[model samples]
Target: MSLLDFLRRRGSAPVARERLQVLLAYERANRGYSDLLAVLREEIVAVIARHITIDRDCVAIKMDRGDTVSTLEIDIEIPHKAGALLVGT
Candidate 1:
């Protein structure tokens, strides 16, 4: 894998020293989010867990800021399961 891509892979625990910027981005965003990331993460897990099984740690939350608006991104890695795919309502 390319060096940059390697650094971008999100894993558990505090990231490596070289990845402090990434860590800080999420940290600052969460702080900017009123330091409620843990609480928000839990609430999100609770709601989604009700519908499907998931590895809670697999959820990666991020916030990217633009001049006018910021975007909140939640990436969840769902494992394959039979008949788990849901179609349009």
Candidate 2:
């Protein structure tokens, strides 16, 4: 393999590990809700897409269950327009 390819893979190992850890945690927490989560994510993305241009891959949804309450948390990353100044760097 080329040196560039080797370096690229080395650089991304940590990121891949982090993603895997998150997946494991989510799977453990959500258990049997995989199907429902997929559908819910799709629907939410569709609704949000009706108004703005967003990267679907940037959307994240997490559900937390408690004894008396369940909370659904959503995070959507809105892409900035070309030449737009961001408030926080």
Candidate 3:
């Protein structure tokens, strides 16, 4: 059976040889993506900082992979201005 057929037949087909080959190639290229994500996260935080008050430590970005697709999720927590104003002098 073809690779695609094999994958369709079984969700996680036991293609260790093929899987390793693909993983090695992906890992080789993913270093750049990882670095880019880190830089992108910092840049995003910087941009958001210019507009609102946020907790940098709460900024989160993650990559999730599924059988057919992958996703990138970004989550940021912004502080409540009203609450802050209430506590201020």
Q: Which residue runs does candidate 1 get wrong by more than 4 Å?
A: 1-33, 87-89
Write the residue-wise lDDT of candidate 2 on 29-75 in tens digits.
87887688679999999997887678899999997865467799999
Please identify model 2 stretches exceeding 4 Å from their true place: 1-34, 82-89
What lDDT, from 0 to 1, does candidate 1 have?
0.73
What TM-score does candidate 1 reach? 0.54
The sequence of per-residue lDDT tens digits that candidate 1 reaches over residues 25-62 is 75676665675657778889888888888899988888
Candidate 3 deviant stretches above 4 angstroms: 1-15, 82-89
Over 1-89, each residue of candidate 3 has an lDDT whose tens digit, in order, gives: 89998877786546777788877877887866768778989999999887777788989999876657879899987677834654774
Top candidate (TM-score): 3
Candidates in order, TM-scores: namely 0.54, 0.52, 0.62
TM-score of 3: 0.62
Residue 84 Cα positional deviation in candidate 3, in Å, after optimal superposition: 11
- Model 1: clashing residue pairs? none
RMSD versus native structure for model 2 = 12.4
lDDT against the true structure, each candidate: 0.73, 0.80, 0.79
RMSD of each: 11.4, 12.4, 7.6
